[model samples]
Target: MQIIELNQLTKTYGGARGITDLSFTVEHGEIFGFIGPNGAGKSTTIRTMLGLIYPTSGSAKIFGKDCIAHGPEIKMEIGYLPSEVFYYDNMRVKDLLHYSASFYKKDCSKRIKELAEIMELDLSKKMDDLSLGNKKKVGIVQGLLHKPKLIILDEPTSGLDPLMQQRFFELLEEENRKGATILFSSHILSEVQRLCNRVAIIKEGRLMALEKISALKENTYKKFKLETLTKVDASSFAIPGVTEWTADERTISFLFKGNINDVMKKIAEMELINIWVEEPDLEEIFMHYYVKEDGSRHEHVSA
Candidate 1:
């Protein structure tokens, strides 16, 4: 089933862009990745979906109900972790989680304890005394204590250590198996590459590409490596489609995402001892969408 639907969803402020004619559907029980560079309208799109801000035109639905009209009802089934977690400084961690749980009108005590143990959060500590990573832990426990059917996370691992991140991912995977759908938004391509089944990429508030992770890997993203007898300036090989590259005195290595001919033509002009071109990593493929086929970079704009 389509759990979330965005139909021609456009939002704008005075004269600036928010999100324009955005349309996509997130399936039930799937991990959907929402990705874009800074100022790509990712947050705006999410806020609109949650009805935190009204859309100037178009509409959205969660669980088949109008988002704005049924915001409260829909939110009851959602667990959200914002990028930055803030709370009343004086409150103890347990108190805060219980307070957040009050909205659901159920006993989340056992569930809260379970999540706290998994996240390694100290409920005895005061909110102000917790480190950034620990505060994020609180947010995680708070969000999941209710066991909501849908989870929305925005840069949820910003302050988490690597070990905690691994544990958190395991937790998410467990939730998914128990019939939860996740909407994961992050700038970390590796995380998205590992966790998301499909991805929706947007730019300047407009949908760019929506593809299955499998297809994305099979797409036209290639890694190029060159070894030359003589040293060549790395800047000389900076083709329109190459964004990620490393160059040494006699070696230039990079990933390419545009017309094969454009890069091949440039390489033909070079004196090479050995050339290697192969499929790039799935993470690198994510960068392909940010650049236009014409080789220009996507400009970052404020949401």
Candidate 2:
């Protein structure tokens, strides 16, 4: 079941740039990664779904209900953590949790305590006295305490340490196992690659590609680097599927998209000192979709 859906969703600012004709869906009980570089339409798309911002065109739906018309009803079953954390300075952590929990119809004390212990949060500290990381922890706890059916996190690990980040992932996984749907947005490729079952790559407010993580790894291009013992003209080896070739003296690196056996046979004929094949990370793939030669958008993803 698709818990969230965005169809031809477009948002335009006075400057005439935001998400464009973007469409995607999140399945129930799945971790969906919304990934892109900074200034990409990630936040714009997220805000539109939350009804925090109205779209210029198109529509968004959560659990089959129109987002704009049914935001209050849908939000009751959703929990959100924004990229930045904001809290009342004079309020203690516990007080803030209590206040946030009060908004929900059910008690969240047990869940809040469990989340606090897992996050190693100190509830006695005043918001003004806490560090940036601690403030983020409070936000996390508040989001998870309600045990909502849908959780939307934007750069959720911004201020967390490595240990805390690991714990957070575990918590998210646990929530997923309990039948919650999640849409997490982040620039950290490895985290998304590791946690998400499916990912949607957005660039300049457009949806570039959407695929299952496994399928993407299997079908995407591979990077091969070879250090030849003798100077070799790498240009002679170019093939139909291969793209983005670069060479410097005896070292050559390029993305290969054909059969591995054929590429290996060609390389074996050369006097290679060292050779390695690696898959491009999500960040590298994102760059390919966003950055332009003249420092402008080269390819715009459809919204």
Candidate 3:
């Protein structure tokens, strides 16, 4: 089942920046990655889907219902952790969580305790006294306490240490295994690569690509690096598949996606000292979308 949907969803703030013509979907039981650098409309798209902000054009749907029209009902099944967290300064962590849990129909007390222990969050600490990381931990605990069906996270790991981040990922995986759907948005490519089943790449307020994580990494660019015995012309490496090409005297490098033999044959024509051919990771593949000249988009997956 489609858990969330966006169709030509656009939001503009007059002269200010916002998302445009964005479209995608998250499946019922998959972890979907929404990735882009800052100002790329990651947050705007999310806020629109959550009904925090109305779109200037088009629409979004959650649980097969129009988002804005059914926000209250839709939100009941959602667990959301914003990029930044703010709370009453005087309240203790436990108090804030309890207040948040009050909105739900079920009693989240026991679940809150379990999550707090797993996250190693100190419930007695006052919100004003907690560090940024601790504050983020509270957000995590608050979001998951009700055992929501759909989890929406925006840049959720900013303040966590490596160990904490690992724990959080494990926790998310556990939830996913138990049938929670996740929509994770972040600029951190590595984390997204490790956790998500599929990803929707956005740039400059536009939807760029959507594909399964494995398929994307498999069919995308391959990294090529060679050190020639002598000076080489950068133009010599400008094959049809080559992109983000660069050369400095005896060193040359670029990303290629076509038949390996074609590129190898070109390299064979040159005198080289050493060479390295490697599969490009998600991060490098993502860079190609950002820096490409023709502005061509990758294969789009149907929402």
The digit string of per-residue lDDT tens for model 1 on 235-258 reads: 777677686788888988888877
Model 2 stretches with alpha carbons more than 4 Å out: 220-283, 286-303
Better of 1 and 3 by lDDT: 3
lDDT of 2: 0.86
Candidate 3 clashes between residue pairs 3 or more apart in a chain or in different chains: none
Q: Quantify all predictions' global Cα lDDT against the true fold.
A: 0.85, 0.86, 0.88
Show the lowest summed lDDT stretch of 10 residues, model 3. 294-303
Candidate 3 residue lDDT tens string, 6-29: 999999999987988888878899
* Cα shift from native, residue 45, model 3 (Å): 0.7
Which run of 10 residues does model 1 get worst, by summed lDDT? 294-303
lDDT-based ranking: 3, 2, 1
Among the numbered candidates, top lDDT falls to 3
RMSD of each: 5.9, 4.3, 4.1
**TM-score top scorer:** 3
